[model samples]
Target chain A: MEYLIIIISAVFVNNVVLSQFLGICPFLGVSKKVSTAFGMSLALVLVMGLATLVTYLIQNYVLINTWFGEKMDITFMQTIVFILVIAALVQMVEIILKKINPTLYQALGIFLPLITTNCAVLGASILVVTKEFSAKGVESHMMNLGESVVYSMSLAIGFGIAIILFAGMREQLELSNVPKALKGTPIALITAGLLALAFMGFQGIV
Target chain B: MSKFKYLIDGIVKNNPTFVLVLGMCPTLATTTSAVNGMGMGLATMAVLLCSNMVISLLAPVIPNKVRIPCYIVVIAAFVTVVQLVMQAYTPGLYETLGIFIPLIVVNCIVLGRAEAFANKHSVLESALDGLGIGIGFTLALTCIGLVREVLGNLSAFENKFSSSDGMLVFVLAPGAFLVLGYLMVLFNKLKDRKKKA
Candidate 1:
């Protein structure tokens, strides 16, 4: 039940893109078409989930663990270490995917490189370590490894849904006449505001 | 080109927010108030200045194929430094900016300048470029934050004029998008007018 609430809240009520604004770059850059949006969404889910899991282990074990009879706390290195890890992980994923599965690699190849700079992946990873999660009527506590993975994957799915839906809107928008000054990105941003307004209605749910 | 031109170009012609549209995440996320927006922009500027100078200095030694990662490491180091300093000096602002201070590592503006201008230019020119772009970004963010704060919270730089509450939505998620969209149109019109003149 708690996990379900987390998923609902993440996907609708507190969407990563619409509400939090973590991945606005890709949310705007890649949402021109539904097919492309779908591709980016899949890539995000894979990377966000994997990155969160790895960062969680590192944060718990290496950064804040006891070492040689002394409590070690170098959590400040969290930013540098996680970024390098995510970058290396993305590269490794690209290579391994090419060797093992050619077609999947072809589909996600371009976006994989782009994912390294996508703040949503890094933001979600950091959130897992820093932010505490609580469901409705439940006491808030730090998320364990299992919950963090679920939360990160759900956040990616939420991002996917928002971007895909926005792409559909943009597809139709391309046909309509828009003011000259607000032709491309400006109009898209307004449309996203409307979408975000609609999503805000779900705030009462969780 | 003159060194000063690089700075002016970043502020006007190549303004990161209004023109290049880089670093949208921080522009939208942290600009709930004027002070918050300016804070985020200045923090980003500090990182950009340091990373640009350092990267330009190291461009010769870093392998071409691995320059991106090298840049990321340099950026991450400075971001860490900024994060620590902000935490110590301005804990309130630090609390508000939260994950964004670290996420500056991925901000396209910093990395974009490094790849585009810094590596190709002398250290002094790159630093000037960083300052120009940083000022441009800072100005843009402060503008957005001022608009949002006034319209949403009925305040400017945390000074409340009408305490009864403004639109209320402007401080929320949807308002950021709406305000930025409309501002983009306004900026384009101004730019077009300048071009015609």
Candidate 2:
């Protein structure tokens, strides 16, 4: 039940995109078409889950662990290493994707490059690092491997939902006659504001 | 004569946050109050200026193929320096800025100017452009911060501590998204009216 609450709360109340503003570049950039958006979301879900699992081990066993049975703290090196790992992972996926389905690769091309620098990608890894669970008012300052993967998957789901919704709205907006200046990002932003307001309703669920 | 336009462009006509919408992560995340915005802005400005200066100095020597990576290294170096100093002295502010601080290394505004303006321009020009754009970014963020703080918290620039309870949304995660989204709309409307008149 607790885990279910964690997942649900993350998806709606603490949405990674709408609420936390982690992945706006891709959120606003690739969200024009629902089909492409779904692909990106699926990619995100997988990456977030896998990346969190690996990064968590890296942090606890590598970055925080030292050779010769000693403990080392190179926490500051996180920024560089995380980006490097994420860049490599994204590239590997790109290569596999290109060989498997060139069209899918083309569809994901823009978003893949965009995700390399996405704060949300790094944000998920960092959140699990920083997240401290409080159970029954007692703070558990540590995250086990299971919890890390769970949180990352939950955050990715939240991102996917937000993107699909935004893409749907943008699709409809394409047909609706609108003002000239507010045709593109302006109207899209206003639409986001209303959606954000609706998302705010989820705050009460927790 | 044409040189003056460069200075004017960054402030109003091509304001980084509102008009161009270049770097929204730091703009929205760090601007819970005027104070946080100012601090983050200054930190970003310092890094931008140094990185621009370094890139301009290296522009003549750095090969075209390797320039982007070189610029990333330069920006990341300065960012690391900022990260270390902040972690040591201002741990609290460091925590408040959170991931947004490290994300600065990837901020399009910094790298954008470095690649577009800094590498092509002279050292002095690069520095000045950094100053102009940095100030523009700061002003835009401060505006958002002021509004978010005032409306969300009711206590302007009260990140430190005070007797009153602020609205808290301005500081919370969602508040950043909502604030920037609406502010963009309002800014667009104003620009539209100005163009009409």
Candidate 3:
């Protein structure tokens, strides 16, 4: 029940893209078509979920502990370290996928490389450490390893839903006649605004 | 001087937020109020300037294979410094901006300028580009922030115009999208006419 609540809230109430504004680049850049959006969404879930778990461990064990056995607060190194970790993780995933699932790798292709710079992945890793989550009027609590992993996956799921839906909207949008000034990104952003307005109705659900 | 053109380009022709459309995350996320938006922009500018200068200085020595990671590390270090300074002095803004500060490490504008301009330019030119682009980003954020704050909160530049007159949506996520979308349309229209002229 607790895990379910976390997933629900992360996916809808506090959507990483629509609400928090993380990962808007890919949200806008890759959502031109449903197929591409789906591919990017799958890549995000895998990378964000794994990156969260790995970053959580690194933060708790290595970043917080100095070599002198003193539990020092080196959290400052997080920005540098987590990004490097994410860069390396993307590479590893690419190599492993190529060795085993070349076809899937080909589909994911360019987006996999682009994930290195995706803010959503970096945002999830940082949020797992800094932000707290709660349910049912309970006191807000920082997530443990299990909770962070679940949170990351759900956040990615929310991202997936948003991009896919937006892609569908953009597809329909292509058929309609928009004002000349509002043709490309302008129309898309306004549509996303409406989507965000609709998503706002789900607030306080948890 | 050619250097003056570089500076002017960042502010107008290639404004990071309006023209290049880089660093949308911070632009959208932090512009709830004029002060917050300006704060975020200046913080980013600080990182951009320092990283651009340092990266240009090190371009000769950084191995090609590892240059991106090297730039990331340099940008991250300065961001950490900014984080500490803000936390110590401007605790309130620090609390508000929170994770967005560290997240600056990945802001495309900083890294993009480094890869595209700073990596190849001389130190003086790179530094000027950073300042120009940083100021451009700052101006754009402040403009959006000003619009959002006034329309959403009935406030202008931090002064409340009328507390009761504000619409809640402008201060929320949806408003950010609405305002930004309309602004983009306006900008695009202007650009089209300029091209024709």
Ranking by DockQ: 1, 3, 2
Give TM-score values for chain A, per-prediction. 0.98, 0.88, 0.97
TM-score of 3: 0.97
Instruction: Identify the candidate with maximal TM-score.
Output: 1
Q: Each prediction's DockQ?
A: 0.93, 0.44, 0.84
Error of 3 at B23 (Å): 1.0
* lDDT: worst 10-residue window of model 2 chain B: B155-164
Give the candidate number with the greatest lDDT.
Answer: 1
lDDT by residue (tens digit), candidate 2, A1-206 = 66776787778888887777788778888899999899898878877887888788888878887778777798787777766677678778888888998987786665776676677888888778866754433346566889778878999899999999999999999999987656677677668767876888888675
Q: Ranking under lDDT, best-scoring first?
A: 1, 3, 2
lDDT of 2: 0.79
Each prediction's total of clashing residue pairs, residues at least 3 apart in sequence or on different chains, is 0, 2, 0
lDDT of 3 by residue, A24-119 (tens): 989989998999999999988999989998999999999887778675988888888999999999999999999999999998876898888889
Per-residue error (Å), model 3, residue B43: 0.6
Instruction: Let me know the DockQ for model 3.
Output: 0.84
Docking class of 2: acceptable
DockQ of 1: 0.93
Which of the predicted structures, 1 or 2, would earn the higher TM-score when compared with the native? 1
In Å, residue B8's CA in model 2 sits off its true spot by 3.7
